[model samples]
Target: MGAKAYFAVAAAAISLSIVAATPAIAAPRAAENYVAMGDSYDSGVGTRTYDSSSGDCRRSPVAYAPLWAKANSPASFTFIACSGARTPDVQKQADQLTSSVSLISLSVGGNDVGFASVLTSCQLGSDQSCFDKVAEAVNQARTTLPAKLDATYSKIKSKAPSAKVVVFNYPRLFDLGTCGLGGLSKAKRERLNQAADTLSGIISGRVSAAGFRFADLRDRFNGHGICSSAEWLNGLSWPINESYHPNTNGHSQGYLAAFKAAIG
Candidate 1:
């Protein structure tokens, strides 16, 4: 899909999409005062993807970054999140961060397109071949994600070193117990999580390698994967139409985990 409107939730996965709304008021995010940065996941993409106006940023309450901030005691915060943002968008859009800030988090890397492409490619492949191909894609993310994270985190640090930086990782598609789509084998989902795991490892490792604290949310969300009864993520209907994006629940889980890690 083309770049979505600033405040609009374009066609995305139902499980993962949060429609855009008017730019909501920036709520308090930390005790020591902090700021938030990232893509639609941070902006609550899946919780609800509707616009307060025709052209406002979707500010769903279920979005993880805002929820995480509100969960803690009130502190000053600045938000620079828009849907469909990738690495370059961040470098250009979110540069005014302050040095004395207390915390920061970035939930990204799903837009690299390899995962979706793999999903599509493996849909018609034999079971063994599907598994093998998915494995390869995840492996690629393992190697490439850290460097991208490193550059972004360093830029964030240059603007806000004192802030506690946490790289939020992606969740598994479906529960380990469940895999296979109506048109595809569930084994691919396992491969999807394996990739997510690899990316998570890269993110956590790179963050720690740079002397920053890393919060690994992968294991913490074991059974709550995409197709779980309580479904925390939405692989097919994410971004409401795009599929594979996190939903409101996904953002909530991320926010809860990130906040608890930052303070508790």
Candidate 2:
């Protein structure tokens, strides 16, 4: 073979080897027809900024879902989650789903187990009352919530069978640490956190059974509960409805972070 031809062949082989050794850049996540559904946590209840058109639902622009939509610029984005929404309300929200939807994010079941009421009772009533309320909520979470969650998930699947649904569980509200005056007693806080754990387990289990991704926020929001030095959750804020929900920081740092991890 000619020296010039041999040199050209060697250079081609070297170029091929370099190409093979270089890592491929990961493609960006595909845009989708994305829908956000569920309750107050998903609706941005504690964020204060809300869309007037959402009315009593109080959907906030800064909530995790909208933040995700704003960042990703999905093919389509719909936010229908409402404050005070229970599992049945979620079933209705499923009506917004369609076969073309490619992504969904949901945070539900807290209201199904009357978490808001439990929090109110714990804060305003006696310690025993708090324990009693926590127990009741736990019982409901264990017994009836599974079926409600399963049915709601099924409805969403039926509506948008091709969508990738991600179910986000609630963070533990209390840090169980010292907080100056007017907070629940340590015993009450422990009970409430335990109840939250039970609920998280149930939701995670049901989400897995339904073949969907479960994003557990408890760990993500660790050291950021109501009593923490850098708290992400609210503690008895005004406009009482915002009392236990995630603040703007929580939605951006906690919920949005978890959702991105789950979807990725």
Candidate 3:
């Protein structure tokens, strides 16, 4: 071929190479910006894949927020929920929220009226002391917890005005009988279960009043509590703090199902 013809061919090849090398611009995502906020139940405290990189938050990738985001492919997911968070702690988590956020899933209030302390006292103390501690917690749940929940929920709404907030409650811990694995006596279990019911009722009432969806897991965990043959919640662990939290099955089956349904 002549020099001029060869040069023209080279130019054409170069143009084709350039075109092939250029990357295609991806289509924008049509998913919401989802933020998960609240306490240990929302943070996956007892899950195997706990992310220490998130510090004391103990955020597991298997946690419902991350699981839901993975399944649905949200535009973005921010998990600000921490372990041992009370209603006040949730206020800090809500700081991560913005007007652009489209979905919020959280589980708070378990720590607000000292639910853990009550459980600990009941699990370790004498029957009389256990009942007394529970009574105190019940009283606080009736009187103090409502105002705290209202303030936190209101703040969350204000921060993420357009977001659909779904607040999840803790599961009932017992089946009214001892499985003989944990230390909780039958009578103690009844009192603790009543406390759980009280807490759930308080949260449900406030969540409904705030126009937020309440994801009730009590019924779902009926046959899967700590005393069940197939337990979904951890019994007394050596660390003690890890006990009473949801196990892997609880997150995958209990919380995930309720969460997906609530969001839908």
Q: Which model scores highest in lDDT?
A: 2
**lDDT per model vs. reference:** 0.64, 0.91, 0.87
Tell me the lDDT of model 1 at 248: 65
* Per-residue lDDT over 214-250 for candidate 3, one digit per residue giving the tens place of the 0 to 100 score: 9999989998987788988888885766788888899
Q: Which candidate would rank higher by lDDT, 2 or 3? A: 2
Global lDDT of model 2: 0.91
Judging by TM-score against the true structure, name the best candidate.
2
lDDT of 1 at 89: 67
TM-score of 3: 0.86
Ranking according to TM-score, highest score first: 2, 3, 1
Task: Write down the RMSD of candidate 2 (Cα, Å).
Answer: 2.2
TM-scores for all predictions: 0.73, 0.92, 0.86
